[model samples]
Target: MKIILDMMGGDNAPLSNLEGAAQAVKEYGVEIIGLGDEAACRKAAAEKNISLDGIQLVNCTENIEMCDEPARAVRTKKDSSIVVGLNMLKEGKGDAFVSAGSTGALHVGASLIVRTLRGVKRPALATIIPAKNKAYMLLDSGANVECRPEMLAAFAVMGSCYMARVEGRKNPTVALANNGAEESKGTPVLREAHQLLKTTPGINFVGNIEPRDVPNGDVDVVVCDGFTGNVILKLTEGVAKMILGMLKEMFMANVGSKLAYLLLRSGVADLKKKMDSEEYGGAPFLGARQPVIKAHGSSKAKAIKNAIRQAKICVDNDLCGTMQAALDELAAQSAGE
Candidate 1:
């Protein structure tokens, strides 16, 4: 399968993107088409000694800047690599499109240009968090900041399908992020969403999941408004770094602490590995007609490599089509009763 890379997008455009896309081609044996200023991409590829055997470069002189309005940039920037790559995906030229550009641009481009699958009211962004035993899916992480109850419920349904198909989880527990686990803990939106999820047949809606439970790996999919999910996700990263710093400081403080650190060095290394965001690569924009995986803006070669790998997995599973069918089945089941 072929995947499109927005070579002009992201902070370190063309060069970093080209390097990563090349790594992906070598490791995953997948075809990659890099979109950007063709000459610059080719020059970068030559500098990195990246063979163009399984990769091709496309030209797009203009680009959607991170500060530009997403909807407007996507509509007006005809020569942007991100926009062109998205159009290619819509036209069946590629199985998926990977971008590290503006998050808003990716959201708008996927929803407006690539379009959502039929019957998907709102396409959601799903990010996988590496917890203790398994990864958890957080939906609408930054997609729709002000989500309605129906929208949140749709996130749960789509999130469930994602975990099941991609992560190989069955009966994945769904939880609504809230202040407390009590039934009446959150605002009217969460309260209403809780009721719908609880009553929705077939889905494993486990009660409200607190922020503390998120890192402890208590549930599979944490459903929340984009604001809350984004807060939780960023906080988790911040806290992980803070704790690691504290541990390192303590270890260097005294001979005994340093000795203890040496003893537990392997364990600490494993923990650090588990927490690496780049290991999981990009986040998938779910419910689109075609898969759109958005890699991190600061992604290196490894992250880009894995994003290409993810693109293959998404298409292999026919992820968008699967969600469409599952959502259709869920609606039909609800109506039949």
Candidate 2:
């Protein structure tokens, strides 16, 4: 499969993107079409002794900075790497598009260029979070700041389809992120959403899930408005980092602790792997006509490479098509009612 990448979209820019592309090409046997300053990308690859055998670079003059306005930058910077790469996806130049750029800009570009599916009101950003035993999906991670009950229900449906089709979960249990697990809990929006999700066919709608219970991995999909979801995502990252740092400090405090650390090093390493965000690659902009992945703005080579792998899986599974079909079924059900 061919994946289009924004080579100059992240904090590390062309170097990290180029390295990731080379690794994806070599390891995953996927063709990567990079859009950015071709000369700079080539020079970086050469300096690193990285071969671009299965990669193609397309020259893009303009680069979109993080400070630029999302919609405005996308419209004005016609030649920017993010815009050009998204356009390439719209024109069917590649199976999927991956970017480690501004999240707002990526969301705007994907919606305006690739467009949303027929019955999808808004596209939600679905992110995989590593849990106790397995990973769960969080939708509307940072897409729509505000949403209606119907929109939350749609996110649940989309998230369920993704977890089942891509993550290989069968009839994934869906839960609403709320103040409590009781059906009477939460704001009007969430309570309404809970009723809607419970009535929505084809989705395994579980009860509400408090933010504290999210890490327990009891639910397969957690649906919430983008504002709340974004807060949860960031807070989870921050807490994980703090815990790991504290553990490190404690282990190195004295000779006795250092000896204990040696015994627990392997287990700690495994825990670190599970907590690493890079392991899940990037978040997918669900509801778009084609697959669009948004990698972290500060993504390194390893993260970008994994994002490419994530893109390939989405393309191979026809994620967009599956979402469209699921939405269509929901629409049909609504019309009948």
Highest lDDT among the candidates is held by which one? 2
Q: Candidate 1: minimum summed lDDT over ten consecutive residues — where?
A: 116-125
Show where candidate 1 strays beyond 4 Å: 252-264, 334-337
- Model 2, 200-248: lDDT tens digits are 8789998899988999988899999999989988898899989999999
Mind giving the per-residue lDDT tens digits that candidate 1 earns over 89-178?
Answer: 999998899998888888988888888876566677788887876778888787778889877877888888888887789889999999
Best prediction by TM-score: 2
lDDT scores in order: 0.84, 0.91
Q: What residue pairs clash in candidate 1, if any at all?
A: none
Residue 2 local lDDT, model 1 = 92
Clashes by residue pair, model 2: none
Give the Cα-based TM-score of candidate 2 against the true structure.
0.98
| True-structure lDDT of candidate 2 | 0.91
How close to the true structure is residue 181 of candidate 1, measured as C-alpha lDDT? 92
